[model samples]
Target chain A: MYANRQWVLAQRPAGEPDLDCFELRETDTDAPTDGELLVETRYLSVDPYMRGRMSEQESYAEPWAVGEPLEGGIVGEVVETESDAYDIGDLVTGQGTWGEYSLLAAADVAPVDPSVAPPEAYLGILGMPGRTAYFGLLEVGDPAPGDTVVVSGAAGAVGSVVGQIAKLNGCHVVGFAGTDEKTRWLTEDLGFDAAINYKTTDDYQAALADAAPDGVDVYYDNVGGPITDAVFTQLNLDATVAVCGQIAHYNAESVPTGPRKLPQLIAPRATVQGLLVGDFATRFEVATEQLSEWVAAGKLTHRESIVEGLSNAPEAFLGLFAGDNIGKQVVQVAAE
Target chain B: MYANRQWVLAQRPAGEPDLDCFELRETDTDAPTDGELLVETRYLSVDPYMRGRMSEQESYAEPWAVGEPLEGGIVGEVVETESDAYDIGDLVTGQGTWGEYSLLAAADVAPVDPSVAPPEAYLGILGMPGRTAYFGLLEVGDPAPGDTVVVSGAAGAVGSVVGQIAKLNGCHVVGFAGTDEKTRWLTEDLGFDAAINYKTTDDYQAALADAAPDGVDVYYDNVGGPITDAVFTQLNLDATVAVCGQIAHYNAESVPTGPRKLPQLIAPRATVQGLLVGDFATRFEVATEQLSEWVAAGKLTHRESIVEGLSNAPEAFLGLFAGDNIGKQVVQVAAE
Candidate 1:
């Protein structure tokens, strides 16, 4: 037996979740059962999708009940193993509880190579966020060479990689971020042709028209609201839009309203498709391998706005709504 | 030389077009030019799409300038011909002016056989609206057996056919219309599984839930407004929406606002695509052949709400906004 510290849902959020919604409490874990591994959590992922699970609304992911321990992607070291799939002290990544230790099934977790990237990367660039940007952009957005590709939430985990992958496909990439620093990182560091600070920009349509003179052929939307409405106005003929996330309205108590866009789509005949990364589970290996190669060759770069300590995991998750993270936001629960 | 009466755009509309927006005037037409045919208009099509041309807004179709004579689909008798492709007294259909007589290039018009259907049928079920329903439903909506296909404007020209085609595809068909008569026509005459009078129904979501208990698998949206918002709520996983038209917003002075629908799409991964029938020009023959066969075999039925004389053309056009016509709306310019 081992002592553990875990975070549980204390109460449901009415709008934006606060620290009061989460309660960290002491717990105990049993030894690894057959086909299981006892792992000590090193890194925990705090994503915007977690907001959906906190509510009772019907969504692709199951909602978490009050008093239930929160579960998420975790990078951990196997402390004890009951299966040959993982040896003791081996680093692995899988869905685990928001705690210091988790007894996860050996078949559920995959071994991570520390040589290719740091262990925390498995919870970010080498994980769900990376695979989402890959298939969502290529399969749904389907940008062709010279096509103008626009990304909302351009500084977030998925949008940052979406813009870079579009560049590799020989397309003109434009991104919408919240801050001047984030926009600069996109245009200067990530090779985005142009970036807009949506927070400061008064007229998104005018800004987008000036940025994409040829009009946008592909739109990968992470932040949906006024930013998305403006992009819809500048869509080129046969434009494709991939709806990945809508962090802007995630905290709204009621459904938000915006300009009706179906009329605008008729003239350009644009297509909008919603996507979830879990749907591409079969093709995750292909994305992981390609993303790993890009990282190794210095072609793709990733940044993690990591908050230290398991107790701060709730804050890290709330920061996503505040646009506090420049890249993938992760919580460092324990040192390697 | 021939004396002709035609309708011209007197002024652009501020909101909904009124009788004052159109002016009927007498004009003179010359003999057919080298490659032209002189056609005496028999049937003129008055469609909802013509409303777009009357406005200066950028749309798929070119906007008509003030004082310009409107042009649309016409079924006429070719009295004078300059090409061997057409003979004198041939019944034909093509893009022609609203005047009694039009000089059209031989290559632009197609000869219509009255034996298959009436010459005016060439303006409707055999023309743009029929082809619009075909490709829009099959190619874009892609409904399969056991799927629940919902159509807005279900009593209108394009939508009536869309629901029928969906029925032929072995799918459950539901439609939303504005009146009790139209709803009856859909469920009883058109073989729709269920129909809702949106005007009488205050809670569209609840009405839809009762109609499509399994949720909507394919939505062919011709009227975009509250009905569309309700449909977005009940979308099944991987549903497809073909946006063919938006008559609900056609008369609005400014862009209309509605509940933002992108977030709702994420959970079901639904696809919303805009479609214009003109894009399927190359496959018009295939649709015409299939639709004609369906009509002749009594498997497909069509009704025309025809207003007598060319003078009522503007009234027929304006009546679309009021939902006065149940099926294909046309103006009978002359006798067959």
Candidate 2:
């Protein structure tokens, strides 16, 4: 038996969710049963998509009910196992509860190797965010060589990797970050051709025009708002926009309004397609292997903004909306 | 030489164009020079797309300059020719001037058979509108069997044919038309599964929900505004939207604002693609042959609201915005 600390949804948020919406509670966990493994949480992922789950609005992910335990992607150490798929002391990553201990089904979790990269890498560049940037940009965006690839929320987990992958594809990669430091990191550390500090930039369209004189051939949108509106205006003929996320309007109490973009699309004959990484589940191994190779070769770099302690998970999540994280935001529940 | 009566753009429109924007002028046509053919105009097609050309705003089609003679699709008889490709009395169609007579390049026109359908039919279902519907729906929308196809401006030149094509492909089709009569024409005459009279319906979303209970699998948007907003909410997973036109906002003086739709796309992972018939110019022969076959076999039907005389061409064009005409709207310059 283990004494577990879990986070529960105290109430549904009307707009921007605060720490008050979360409730930390103490619970007890039983030993692993058949096909189950007892995992001691090492890292808990906090993503922008979680904002949708906090409300009752219909979304790709199911909404979390009030008073129910919160759930998310977790990388943990297996203390006990009833399945042959995993052994004691093995590290695994899967969708698990935001608690100190989680009894996860063996099939739901996949074993991770710490030798190649740290266990938390399974939560960021080597996990869902990595796979998302891979398929969404390559398959959906379809960036060709010499194409100008633009990414919104480019300093974050998914956007940072998207710019790097596009660069590796011989594209002129440009990104949008909230801070000047993050923008510098994108162009300097990540090899991006250009990075715009969206927070300080008065006119996004002008900035983008200067950055991409040939116009944007591919747009991987992680943030949707005025930035996306500006991007739409500069789409080249037959441009492809991969709608990966709309973190900008995720907390709106009502449907937000923006400039009508359908008219802008007509002139360029552009394609705007929404995507969820789960749709590419069948080919995840392909992404995982390629991403691993890139990381090992030092071709792709990553950063993490880790908040210590399980009690800080809510704060870490709330930080995403404020653009406080430079890369993947994860909570450290216990020592690795 | 032949006396010609032509419509010229008197001024650029500020909003919905009034008749003052057009000026009828008297001109004279000389003999065909080199490869040019002197043709007598028979039918002048007035379409929703023309609204885009009246404004200086950037669009797929180039804008018309003030004091310049207007031009559009014209089916005419060759009175004189200098090239071996065509001869006198050859009934043909291509882009020609809005005048009683036009001197066209031999390479610019294609010969049309009056026996296949009427000469005016070349201006409607057998021409640009027909080809627009064919490729936009089949290629861009990519409708599948049993798909619930929803069309806005369903009674227009392109959209009416789009609904019929979806039906031919074994799909359940729903349409949004302006009037009860238009809705009746869709459901009763055109074999649409359901039709909503958007002008009379107070709640478009509710009306669509009742009509398309399973949600929209394919959307061919011809009209943009609230009708499109309502359809966005009902998109099924992996749905495809072929943006053929946005007649509703063509006359707007400034960029219009609407409910942000990128967020709605996430759950369904829908694709919204803009299309221009010119992009599929290489395969127009394939579409023309298929459309003619469907029309001949009685599987397809079309209607044209013809306005007599070239003098009424401006009136015919203006009537499109008011929804005064049904199906294809054309001006008859002279008797066949």
Candidate 3:
């Protein structure tokens, strides 16, 4: 018998999650039943949304209970198959069991095309976050040609792709990031029209005015704070705001406070819509096809920050809240 | 030749508008040329939207300059005809100059039928606010049957109509009001399933939860503040928030600080959309016909708060900020 190492929720967090929130555990794994395949853990995605699931409250997805394995979307290789659907050495992606060797139902895993993109690409650009940016920006936000598109958290996985897609669609793309380096990457490398380093800026509203002089036609919002309020002030008539994430205020112990400027709703006739990627499950193929094509054409690019081992997953995941990760944060477990 | 009596903008207000913002004046009129005609103002509207127009900032409509006569959608009678298109004593609705007598282009006015509804009905049930409530709720909100529909400022013009329409559409209508009298009016006269007097209720979120046990599926927002934030917490999956107005925060000098709960966007996959009634101008007939049918069938009802005399218009308009008017506020300038 071999010990199966996994990460478990140690405690629910307050303002920010700490090391105590997660604990590494070793457990004995039983043999897989019929139709179950054993996958060797490889790439585990550490995302901002996982912060929400740590709590016990009811949410879009089930909460992660204390002492239970913390799960996330992951990619791995099948070492032993008890089902006819998967074979040995076949690489697949599905919900992570966190253990070194996890038993999954044949139905949960999907085969990946290695020739299309790198294995890590499935965890970032070709995966849920990528598809999320693809669908949320295109399907919901709907940027028209010459439209001024603004994206918050612009250096992150989803915001980066969203801005790129808007640029590709002939929009003048502007982005907001937490750092100067990220801002430079957006404007100089990622083809954004302008980039605002929100950290250094004294007035977000003024910065937005400078970046989008005409007015923001589409705001792909990932960080919902004062930046979003500033964007709200500058929205053009009939502007669309895709509420993809709100990492800025997620860990607050109490409700955050701000200007009661909701009256601004009267001016531009804006639409602020909240989106979850699972809502567009049926449209995944369409987004993947378009995204893959763009990547192959060198029109789209992605960056990832891969942590060394499963033990470091907690730190990497917590890094998202601190703006430490340059791009998508993923944990490399074992060699495929 | 008679000099026209008029009220013009005397000065801009620093906070709440007072008598100092307006001045009574008499001016000579120029004779109508080619397409122009002379009209006598009968009823001028006092609405919350005019406050937005008074400011110098860019908004949905141009700002009212100091020393200029206040202009809004009003009902009038054609006293003198210069264009071939109009005749004397023609009852018309137009964006009139706020004076006893004014000049207008023939094309600006529309002929009204006083037989179907009262002359004042043209200013209330058949007018701009009416059309605003009609299309903003039905077209954009699209409340499904059995949906828990919550409307703010429930005893006001737009909110009152929005509640009635939601009830007619088979929704469980819940209303929010500023006073006990308004709450009683909403429940007793407006057919709302429940009413919450926000001023009296210490916990709006708890009150809303009690009112809507199933959760809110449609929120027709007329007042945005803590009330809007409270409603955000109770939204069901795929909920729709039709932002028709934000009266609560309109007079605020700065944005209020509150618990920032934008993360709720991802939980419910919700939508908050701003509405401009003019955007649906092409379908005015559709709204009129449908509203008329509902009114005729006794499925919908409306109430008006009449303020006597043109001079009372400023005070009546300011009543909106204090939540004094129970229903649609209109100034009676003259008798038919």
Candidate 4:
């Protein structure tokens, strides 16, 4: 047996989780069972959603247990296999313990093609977040040609992909990010028609209206709160808002208050829909194919902030709440 | 020429619009031209939507002028006809002025079958409000069998029909109304599975949870402030909320602070969509046929609080804001 360094939930977080909430310990790595494969994790995807799993609140997924392994999406190689589905050295990605090594069912892990794209990409633009931005915006948001599409948290993994995909769909995309650098990247690099620095802007509604003169036809909300309130005001008649994530209030001690204009939903006749990527699990292959094609054709681009070492995984995960990561934040476990 | 007594919008009100906003003046009615039919209004349907039209605020329909007659859905007799499409003594319904006698294009008005249902029923259950409830609930809410549907202002015009239609669609319909009598009507007369008296119930959310243990699958929101907030907490996974109206908060001096639980949207994967009957104007006839069939089969029932004489029109119109009308509030202009 080898050593497995795992991070367990020590305490439930109040506002933002710190290192005290997570207890990192090294334990004996288990051998593959009859239908299981042993994987030495090469990369761990530190996503914003992990914040929800750390809490005892009613969420989409079950909360992480105290003294148990914290789990998230991981990309690794099969060190040993007890099933025909996976072989030694085969690259795979699946939900795994936040550790250096993990033993998972062969069926749970999906093999990746390294020739088309890098292996790290399976945890990002070609994985759950990518598929989420793909189907959620296109399917639910149903943006038309020349329609103004606005995205919040524009510099993050999902928001970045959402804006680019919307641009590909012939929509005039606008984005709101926290920083000037992110805003610059959104407008100058990501092909976003306009990018608003929400932090500096005094009036978000005014900024949104100035950015989108035609009114927003599709709004992909990643950072909810005042930003969402602003976006709601500029919604065109029959506009569709894809509620993917609410990163803003995730770490809040108390809920924020604003102008409750739920009545505007009637006047403009807009649609506000919440989306979870797990619902589209069956369509991963289709999404990967389409996203891969775009990436290969140089039509799509992705960014990753690689935080080195497995011990720093919890910090990287917590950093998501503070908007520290520029893009898809991934923890590098070992050299490929 | 006949003298036309018109009700004009004199001024905009701060809170609830009073009779002072409308001014009664006499003018000569124009003769019916080529394709015009002179319809002597018998039943004038005064609705809550007219309140919005009287204000200078931007809306789907244009604001009423100070010196012009207030118009709404009206059923009348073709007293003097000048077109091939209509003949004298034919009973018809069209969106017309509040005046006793009004001129309408033959193409704009449809002949009502007095034999199938009463002429007054044409202005209530079988007319605009009925069709509005039918399409708004079914089209936007898309209530599936065994789904729990919660409606706000459940005893009002559009909402009463909404509950009945949902019940017919095999849903467990729950409603929130202002009075005990209306609540009884919703549960006893309208066949609603449950009813919540908002005026009596201090905690609506707790009451709703106690009433609907299964959680709400469809929320047909007519009163969109606190009642809607209560419903928001009880929303199940993949729930759909149809924003038909928000009469409760329409007259508020300032925007209220509602519970900001937008984060729950992601966990439940809910959808809130706004709907307007005018958007589905083309398919109204199809909706009317389905509604009429339901009413004929006794699967659906409706109530209309009728006011006699055009002089009581302002009072009947004002009654809408107070939730005084049991179902459709119509003003009788002339005897058939």
Candidate 5:
């Protein structure tokens, strides 16, 4: 077995993380034991939620201890297995360490079909991000047909899918993305009724008003900050805001404050709900089947900005805050 | 038969409303038209919602025109009836002008049985406040057994009932109120598990944390602002926040700003839903029956801060902002 190289949290970041926060280290590979599978990493995911783990503060997720290897969604191939469930050639995806190799329990990883889709897809469109967009939008946002569905971070992994799903459901979909290019992709490619370039616009509320003329019925929020504050202004009566991720405030030095929204909510009779993908684990198979069907029908298009190599994983993660990725941010460790 | 004395919005206030904002006028009483009922106002409700109507700025409720007679919840006895639904001496409640005599359509008013409860109880316990507490708590808050339920404006109309209902449903109830007497009333009279006098406490978050040691499971938010912000800090995973009113921000000159709470909601997967009592009008019969049963059985106790005379109605409505009235604020326009 080759020596496993991994990225470990060297220091807890004060605000936005730099390269110094992560230490690329060479560690001895642990052999597969009974009931475990030694998987060689192929593709690793870099999501916004991982940023919360980098901090020392207590969040919904247990804070990752400093000096420990960063663990995330990883798509890997079964190299050597000591369990009865898998063979040497099966590709699996699960929560794993950001390394070349990880010793995981047999049940921890689910065997994925590369024939139905690409192996890297399990890290993006067909995986955590896909499920997050699905449940958070359909279950929490609860958009009805002909309703206006607005999504912040509309080009990111989850938000992109949320827009597409809302469009498919016969809703008037409006998207707020960071770039003009992302906005075009939303309107031209993804069937969104309107797209707002939030970075270019001085007044997001005005831009959103132009897009969602009927007002926002469902808001699937991935980027929370001023953009969300603007979205709150245009909420229709009985609006549902599904808080998927707050990527904007994830790296703040302290909990930041802005315009109070509680008052705004009362008049509209709106609903805002926080969501995590892990909570929908039980219904994953159902969501995956629906997501897979949409993908197969050419209705759902996915984009992945795969940064080549494990060493660039931290850089790719840091790039998310800069809006560097078009869709999913994945680290390609090795080709299957 | 007599000159109808009514209150009109004389001027829109810049900050806190004053007695000058209201002007008492003697208006001619309208005789009952065919299919209409002439009702003499007996018990008038002065609620926080009325404060929103006085403002020129558009809100959920229609703003009161400068010269028009103010309209609100009025329980009156039918003096003369041209409609088959109502008879003379029958107590009916509906939206009516602040004048002693009002011409109402039969469909506009509902016959309220004072024999089951009291004439004033219909304007208090089994009224809008009762229905507001019922739907906002059960439908929006969704408190579970052993869950910690926290309510702001605990001594007021809706809040006092929220704590009691939550307590009755087998939840640990914590309340926050402006005065020690109100807080004591919450614990001693209404069966709240703990009550914090927010006026005396410097750190409301700490006080709330102490009261809700297991963390807040459901928050029935009546007075939104810093109190709601403190509740957000102690929210359990999947907690629910029912936003009934923002009495704190109703009088603000502009849309007010405070510590942003959208970021805090992400981790806990909490839900904050804005509520308007009228939305649940379809199910109000069920709610009113439950509330009435509780009131009749002596399980529910209602205290009315009745301001005698219709001339003082404007002052009573303004008093809501000053935290002057406790429980349901009502104006006794005439004796039943």
Candidate 6:
């Protein structure tokens, strides 16, 4: 019998996390039930949202319990199926255990279209990250044509897609990323009007001023901290800040303090709204189809930084905050 | 000719204001010109927002010019009229100079009705504060029935009305104030479910836990600081934070830094929006009429802390930040 390997939560992190917080263990692969499908995970998504689950603090997503396997979006091939909905060798993607094998209910997984793009794209551009960008940018950010749309954590899974979508909406898109490579990718490949290397820039305000001459009208915020404060000072009248993530402060032992922005909002009559992709669950298919069309038409580009092997999943996740990956970070757990 | 005494802006204050920032000067009043109305000021409105105008900082309202007379909402009687639209002894309320007499166009001011409530009520419950509460609560706060609404600076003009409006929307209202008397007024008279004297309470979270058993759904934020931080932690899922004012930080020499709340907001998917009464200018008459009915039907109760005389306008304005008055803080400059 084959063994199933998974990375489990070993301990809650204090401040910045290390490999000690994760425990990789092997277990016996269970047989499929009467209504279950035996899935072998081909790719495992490692995202900033997973950081919130590593801690026991209250968050939108429930915390991962110590000694339990972490759960996330996984792309896998159905090895066997007890139900008629999914057959053997069919690729499927859904929320699954971060393990080499999983027994999932047929209704919980959606069939993946590897023909349109790579099988891994189902977990990146065609999945949660894609939907997050679609609704967060269109509904929450509300970028109008000719408006300047600024996105933080650009060149990441959601942020990259956000900039592309904003461009398609006829707005000038500006991006902020950690490295020169990411910034170059955003501006050269992703069609961003301008991109700032936040790590290399000494003055974020000046950098934004040079890049965004018209001022930010729609700020899609993924990394919240001093960068966000700098962006607030440049927000145009009636600017909208779509708070999709706060990766910068996710690992802090305590809530960090910063310059208050509420007073600044009053002057411009701006709006700051926190968002979750699950809130738009009913429109996933719409967004996914749109994203697929864009990708196919060469209007949208997706880049993936994949780590090989199941044991390296924890490292792949930790790399997110370190700015190690330029785009979607995923782990190749096994071959189909 | 009669002399008109007016309070002018002397200099911008560094932190908290002093009497030196205001200069009272005597000027002679000229006779009314053709189609002009000569009005004798009756009541002068003093509000917390006036602090922003005193500083050179950018805000919703334009800054007050140094050495020029400050203009604010004033209720006055028509002592002489050259236009057929207004007659002698008619009471009117509009943005007027901080002086005893003024020449105004008849169309610039609205006729105040003494029958609905006292003429001074035109500047309090039937005026800006009331309309601010009605729109900010209904449109921005968007409280649903049975929702728990928490209001900061609950004893102040806009906040007091905000609590009542939330209550009228069938929400359970809780308030935070500086003094026990103000808290008592919020609970006993304003129909608030609970009131907490934040100045006396050392533990805000525990106080909120004891008060808001179901958690806060709609937070009408009037004072933004530590109290606002506490409220952010207690927000329910999809909560709304209506940012009406930040009176607590108005007097600070520099922009104050505090615990970053964006991360906290991510979990609740909350919204923080800035509001101005002028935003709903098109619907002001509608709200004013509804507020007038509420006052007549005894559905709404408003309290005014009246300071006597125009010479004390500077003191009355200063009293707002010190929490010296409850509900509407206005100066009865002269009797009708």
DockQ of candidate 2? 0.84
Q: Candidate 3's residue-wise lDDT over B1-336, tens digit each? A: 447888899987766678888887888777677888788888887888888777777688888988999988777888888888888998888788667877889987777777666666677777887898899999889998899999998898889999988898899999999898899889998899999999989999999989999999999999888788899889999999888888776665666566565677678888888888989999987888888777777777777788888878888888889998887887778788
lDDT of candidate 5 over A43-69, digit per residue (tens): 999999888898888887788889989
Model 6: pairs clashing at backbone N, Cα or C within 3 Å? none
Local distance difference test scores for all models = 0.93, 0.93, 0.85, 0.88, 0.89, 0.90
Top-scoring candidate (lDDT): 1
lDDT string for model 6 (A1-336, tens) is 357888889998888889999998888777888888989999999999988888887578899999998899999999988989988999999999889988889989999988788889888889899899999999999999999999999889999999999999999999999988899999889899999998889999999999999999999999999889999998888899999999999888887999998888877778899999999998899999999999888889998899999988888988998989878888998865
Q: Judged by DockQ cut-offs, is candidate 4 incorrect, acceptable, medium or high?
A: medium
Report lDDT (Cα) of residue B281, candidate 6: 95
DockQ (C-alpha based) per candidate is: 0.91, 0.84, 0.73, 0.71, 0.76, 0.79
Per-residue lDDT, model 6, residue B190, is 93
> Ten residues in a row with the worst lDDT in model 5 chain B?
B115-124
Q: What interface root-mean-square deviation (Å) does model 6 yield? A: 0.9
Q: Tens digit of lDDT per residue, candidate 3, span A104-131? A: 8989877777887777778888898899
Q: Write the per-residue lDDT of candidate 5 for residues B194-234, one digit (tens) a residue.
A: 99988899999899888889999999998988888889988
Worst 10 residues of 3 chain B by lDDT: B252-261
Ranking by DockQ: 1, 2, 6, 5, 3, 4
What fraction of native interface contacts is shared by candidate 1? 0.89
CAPRI-style class, candidate 2: high
Candidate achieving higher lDDT, 2 or 6: 2
lDDT of 4 at A212: 94
- Relative to the true structure, candidate 6 reaches a TM of 0.98
Expressed as tens digits, the lDDT of each residue in A1-336 for candidate 2 is 888889999999889999899999998999999999999999999999999898886678999989988999999999999999999999999998899999999999988988778888889999999999999999999999999999999999999999999999999999999999999999999999999999999999999999999999999999999999999999999999999999999888889999999988888999999999999999998999999999999999999899999999999999999999998999999996
Using TM-score as the measure, which candidate wins? 1
Provide the DockQ value for model 1: 0.91
